[model samples]
Target: MANKDVEIVKSSGKRVKFSFDKLRGSLKRAGADEKTINHILDIVRDELYQGISTKEIYNRAYALLKGKETFLASRYSLKKAIYNLGPTGFPFEKFIGAILKYSGYKVEIGKILNGLCVSHEVDVLAEKHSEFILVECKFHSEEGRNCNVKVPLYINSRYIDVKQKWNGINSNKPLTEGWVVTNTRFTVDAVKYGNCAGLHLLSWDYPKGNALKDRIDRVGLYPVTVSTLLSSEEKQFLLDRNIVLCRQLIEESFMLDHLGVSENRKQKIIHEINKLCNL
Candidate 1:
């Protein structure tokens, strides 16, 4: 049985019915080319079965586009491809926002700043009691080797315009810190650049010898997981075993034993736990 729901409806008065052509039209409007559109449709048609929802159709299309190297041809294509991927990207921002919020900060997404002749869009802007934070969200397979340098470059190139427009306001006013969030781990050079630039960097994976706890402290963010949030017993078990670090969870052999759960059940349990806790 399919895990998702799909529905179909015939035309009603002025309302047109759903069709593959409609999907293609939508993709075209989003700036996808004919080849990309056809590729997306092929994936959907092959994977889709009866009763698939329109949203699921978009998700499959986005996933297919994400897998294509050509999708990275331009920023327009990147945005369209990401938009098609449903709300997965939002969670990356929201998770970081939650941590900031928990620490008594205000978080805003997609903040727009109009410069003298250009514009900039910041992913998540965080305002604490005394500091301002700018975050850029990137969901990639591997956090690029230049991920760290990239954040400062982006800030220097794009954010500088915003800053210049504001007429050199002091650091305490509108901008105080910068952050880059990625799915994969960061390279050592990237980490060093972040430290040098006074930027915070967060990723899904941690490097060797740098414990997750250590990385979280260095990045000024916490390592969060659905399992850690959902299961009180599991959380306590980890705490008792000194497994507060994500790297520890991944590297420490005793995690399963500490949780008193077998390896076979861990994956499913982790999935359900993440869903429940929103980690």
Candidate 2:
């Protein structure tokens, strides 16, 4: 089969060409049914608008397939979609790492240490001044119910275990702080346990009370949105255009923009901004 060309505009406003043949080849290798592949392609073609990146097209296709009957089908579809897009997860890590570095912290990625060895790699380790922080990043469309408990357990097994080992080494170094950052909200019990254990948890939804933000600020690891991190010029452009591009960009990049921003809070902010701008 011949490659089908598509044009994508980058963030810098440069148009780059891509091909869909690789995606079709991947689907064929994955043994996807013809009907499904055609459906996905049709949806992508119908939905993708001007200036849409290949990554955006894939994300849209993934969201479309997620409504299907079989979980495996959805997973397969998403994997193919991501392949069509490009590298995503590590970019998110780097973005978050940059934020920490901006705030005067040393950031390390995929560091291996003498920890509990929880069977998975820790995303980022950050140190500032004299305090150590362990960050675990989860980049998923939606976090499951166990997402909260799982993070604490991983932190306890990894960071806490590493600290215990460190104590054995020096017995004087300070303990590392634990932080869990996810694309979805944390469970109520998870929040309660995290607070009690002095572990910092940041997620899509900030609990109703002031405590969550307070804890984040005090710990010097406040939740940051890509929107917040963007320069004033970018922010104004986003606001002026009412561009859903920010959300689309984050989704395509597999980044967490919804984290720490709840539906209610988002609505309120949009409302306030609209009122002030009289838009």
lDDT of 2 at 65: 44
Q: Which sections of candidate 2 miss by over 4 Å?
A: 1-88, 116-120, 142-146, 170-173, 207-279
lDDT of each: 0.53, 0.50
Candidate 1 clashing pairs?
6-51, 6-52, 6-53
What RMSD value applies to candidate 1? 16.3
Candidate 2 contains a number of clashing pairs equal to 3
- Candidate 1: 10-residue stretch with minimal lDDT: 70-79
TM-score of each: 0.41, 0.42
Ten-residue region with minimum lDDT total, candidate 2: 78-87
lDDT by residue for model 1 over 1-279, one digit each (tens)?
A: 322343442221222234777777656644467898888877776676654555556556655544553212221122222222223565456545655565688888778977656978777888877667777776543212224456556655565566566545545576766677665556677778766766666665444435322333344333323232225556446545544333345446457666667766666544433322224
| lDDT score of residue 237 within candidate 2 | 40
- What candidate 1 gets wrong by more than 4 Å, as runs, is 1-88, 141-148, 167-172, 205-279
